[model samples]
Target: MHKPLLVPEFLDRARTHYGDSEAVIATTGERFTYDELGERADRFSAALQERGIEKGDRVAVLDPNTHYHLEAAYGIMQTGAIHTPLNYRLTPDDFAYILSDADVDAIYADYEYAENIEAVRDDVPTETFITNDVDAVEGEWESFDAVLEDAGTEYDRPEMDEDEIITINYTSGTTGDPKGVCRTHRGETIHAYLTVAHQEISDDDVYLWTLPMFHANGWGHIFAVTGIGATHVCTRGIDAAEIFETVREEHVSYMCGAPTVLNMLVDYYIEHEPETTGDAPVRLATAGSAPPEATIRTVEDEFGWYLKHVYGATETGPLITTSDAGRLFEADSDDRFRIKKRQGLAFLGTEIRVVDEDGNDIPRDDETLGEVVVRGNQIMEKYWGKPDATEEAFTDRIEGYYHTGDLATIDEHGMIAIQDRKKDIIISGGENISSIELEDTLFDHPEVSDVAVIPAPSEKWGETPKAFVVPTSGDPDEPGVSEEDLVAFTRDNLAGYKTVHRIEFVAELPTTATGKVQKYELREEEWEDEDQMVGQG
Candidate 1:
């Protein structure tokens, strides 16, 4: 009964119980059964060992959403090495910083991203470079396939302690330098169970790789799906047409993405109608930012898919809450749309509280804003090599809770609604304005495709909300909707104080890889000359 909780157990269970079942369909048209996939993972582990990689060594994976990434994950974990996944969207210099920070010893990179690693080859401490594409391999780099061909399938699983760090996921450095969050084998295992239990993944499920595997370990879906023996349908990148086609061809039952990806799919679906709607009902879990109610309605009504809005950060299991419409609201309730827009109840083993600055719980009135703090088994252990940052993150302010840094509110039904980021909240004339509220209202405008709201400098009121709009039609320089029209529209819908005072039409909003808007970037530009930010005043 004292078995150590390890990540490899998931793959071992799938290989033993579902040996002949199809486990993965790669973007390169490679198919593998559970047995074959397991063997490949073992071979990868053996190959790393042959290259002198040992337990506790850091192994970085730089690849897109492919079967090779999946293999690299399990392979690296099996060898007791810490797996560090790199975001392909990052620059070579960004990769260099992370590789050097994590003290990575070896890297398994996709050929498409090999150039990024090669660009920083001399800067990092990594000694071995393995490329999946053999032809792309040159000068001190090893071919992944060639190594697999020569390596044995019998790799000895390294003895691992459950509480030891298994992975280091770097945050998207939107505000500043990215911080590496260290996650242990125990934490990841607990997160996988929570994901499977809450999402209801099964062997009959076909999961499409819409979310990148680099993001919080694909939101821990990589372990959840594999644990249940589900089929993994890999895609190189997110393309609306390809996603729709794969859903029809593979009968994809479940997938996860940010609202931005859903918006792209909906846009494509409206323009070019696809004929084949699969036999099974499709389930999608979306996060990153609270989606507009219109987006949620479209996903449910037009696409006929079940939409679940999940919420969390890279440090908190990346899945601490979910808003399932059927469970949270009446089937025919008019307020269902509004309720579904909330971040919703905490996960099964998680606890969430919205508290005031004094560490007291805020009223469940859904109006008062407070910091949302969480305590759960799935929370990351610490920020790697940043003891000061880790201590500040888990300070006694909340007492045993991890500060989320998200300002939120709790409704009577106990659902949590994120108002805005603590730093992004606009304080104008002694009143707080939630930018998310204004952005949601603007999303209802037919001419507005995407929008970002930031606190712009205002000498009179300290700061005022500024709307950066991306139009749905016409040239970017001259949008269909004018500034006066948008200002009037918000005034009609929101309070006088919350109404956007300034409007600037732009081509598109800046977003992270996961599609969350980078409001801090806009804020920095607006407050560059100012000594302090809006809230500071």
Candidate 2:
């Protein structure tokens, strides 16, 4: 018997294997089972077909994490239409560019974002529009519910190959314009398998959707949860009280989030009473950053939650690696905390290597830094339209390997530690400095909530380290951290050059749509003028 690689097969297996299992529970308080979800997904497919949506048509969905959004993902896949999930926070102009770039034929948007869609309606190639909130619909958009109600249940799924496009994920381009990262059926299915294996999730686990759906298909949990028949609890926005309440009331067993979300939960647990049960403790998976050692300690000690750190980009299905295995440090709390800090080794069927510009493998000495490269089934096929961009990204330095553009060092145990972004490394006075190391140390301070390190001009040393910090409590204009005090604090922890020469407390640091700090923006502001550079040198 041949195996099916399509996404609908996964849904069919769930309905056949665990038909009555609870598939999803909406934040607005609606319960749905696997069988019900499958039926709804099929109904959505039929509705789209009735509107003349054929195979390979681009369909965009703009909404928060909800049951309808999940249904739309599967329904679009069932019809062989590419699912394009849009970030609701993006400006109308950004949305218009993506819509026109992808040549989307139809769009299903929430009531809150209908106006934005209408603003760029004439620019995009959209022929059909469906609004989720019927009462909130304006300017002649069709009702989503009415469309489904009018369409019959009979529908046929298009024949699709494993390499066919399933999703077009737009990555926030820091250097230039945003490009669409196209995901194929084979890539998505392989990544879901990798995630399930690395996370060790089972059918009994109750998954909480803390990460947004628009983010790499919730880091590909949308398929992993369905693959394992896990129950999903969807939350719109990150609210500490709401997250705590849902975890307690629903007894959530597994969830995923960025380090920012984990930091918030740690603060909540410290400030308020935490909910617990005699059953198993919740497992929290975090990525986007390595997470400060303090946040890792708090999650493990105070909340009694097992924290796993994963690392990946939108182009890699966002499930490249996870830190879960226990070493000798498993017995020692301090030692284990340090182990959790590493991005950890690769999952089964994935190979990771740190190589120099010459394409030679670097030693696992834990000190020599090199560009991290990978070869796996989880990597995306290519960027949607720009072939030159895809070629440049994939063929960066070493030949035939996907250059991650992340500088990393591998330890003796084969665990990878991210030094900094390839462009984030600061070269000051002929010495290569890791800004991430400085940022991690500053995060230890009690008053600091967020911190980013960038190079500042220096007359004597060529370039010096500057710290841009965000105070957790005080106003940025007058943060509690004085420049002198912070300098002294760093001098005690780090070396001479590593010590921060200047400090500025800002309201907040710039971040990408997926919550990664935009250090290049800070670099541009600091080194924007030619006269300033001449004077500093």
Candidate 3:
């Protein structure tokens, strides 16, 4: 007999085994056990069905890392609707594009961000708008609690296949226009299994929501942690001091973040020198960019927490490899730092290879740079509504592998070290910012004649977008536009995080013989002192 792997079973199993056990400790300081959370999810499912959300309908969640996100997501999936979670940091215009592209049927936004969605409501196909605090939010929105209460805790669960698409996570990445990455029940299920094994999630573990839930579904932690019956301690946003305090107060055992987050904690530790942990042991898994060797050492040696450096993209489950192998190096040896810096061996059931332009495997000399390609069950199924893009991503270098535009070197142990990016993407502070996107925005400025945006190493943000602008004045020293003005211009036009952090006036950008602007020259100049062009810690 064949059995299907449905994601809702994760909650079902918890309710069966640990129903009376605490499941979620919300940002509001409210707690819910597995049975209670299950009921809430059931009611939400009933409400969505009542609102005409049928099988395959897209339902969007625009909330922070709260208990509501979990309930809403499960609810959407329970009715067999696709769970599409948008980045909360995106602008109203961004939401408008995603909502229209996904053809979203309904949305459950946090009170704080509902206005952003409401601003573009008429432009999108989404008709139903629900928020946690309807009274606090302006305009028309049903209260989430009220809707669940009104609807009984019963709804028909459509027949599901493991291959059925259940979630769409949009990546507003190198292309500027966000492409919805479709994930299947099988892929997400396999990803959760792999995440639990690689990240070592446990039943008694107290997991903190330091990472955003919308991000690759919190890098698949929402499923991995819940499936493991771990306690969730939710937070509205990250505060280094508050995180440390939560570690003590809630006995948080495990969390995840990017290199930027690791740096923030280290900075806070150095400045304030607070107690690092509670009775429970702490482990942090970081991935957006590789952490510097120093930061890893500080986290392991000073903070008394284990740091697991990982590597992946939005399409590749964001957890294909981890640098947490302990058998390779001595326990206390300093050599562990170097080993831990590289994105370590591939997880079980995942195959990672560094291939050249000819699609041939590069030698494992730890020096030859090649594009990283992956083939795994955990990888996304395809880009929603973008067949050509999906086909190109899979067929670019090899027939069946997803070619990651990251340039890396593989060692004898098959450990990969990311060095540079082959794509025109700037990963600043763990967020993907397209160089062309920033360049296009800057080119729109009246005072700007020409512009090239590149990644500049930052101590705080790891990598920040730096623009080299040739002002209409044409003189490098006498460029009419001030740096402050350009920075503010970007903030006004785009999301706040995508703002250009630094601007340098240049006489002219370096160009190829055919007159194409050479962005590598600008990148080389910006990252002269760094070993890798990407963020380090």
CA RMSD of all predictions: 1.6, 2.3, 10.8
Instruction: Say what the RMSD of model 1 is.
Output: 1.6
Backbone clash count, each prediction separately: 0, 0, 0
Task: Report clash pairs, candidate 1.
Answer: none
Rank order (by TM-score, best first): 1, 2, 3
Return the TM-score for each candidate structure.
0.97, 0.95, 0.81
Q: Candidate 1 regions off by >4 Å?
A: 137-139, 325-327
Summing lDDT over every window of 10 consecutive residues in candidate 3, give the lowest-scoring window: 511-520
Best-matching candidate per lDDT:
1
lDDT tens readout by residue for model 1, 82-175: 9999888899989999999999999999988898888889999999899988577445678888888999887777789999999999999876
Query: 197, model 2: CA deviation in Å?
Result: 0.9
Stretches of candidate 3 above 4 Å error? 424-537
Which 10-residue window of candidate 2 scores lowest in summed lDDT? 528-537
Q: What is the lDDT of residue 49 in candidate 2?
A: 88
User: What's the lDDT of the predicted structure labeled candidate 2?
Assistant: 0.83
Candidate 1 weakest ten by summed lDDT: 271-280
Candidate 1, residue 49: Cα displacement in angstroms equals 0.7
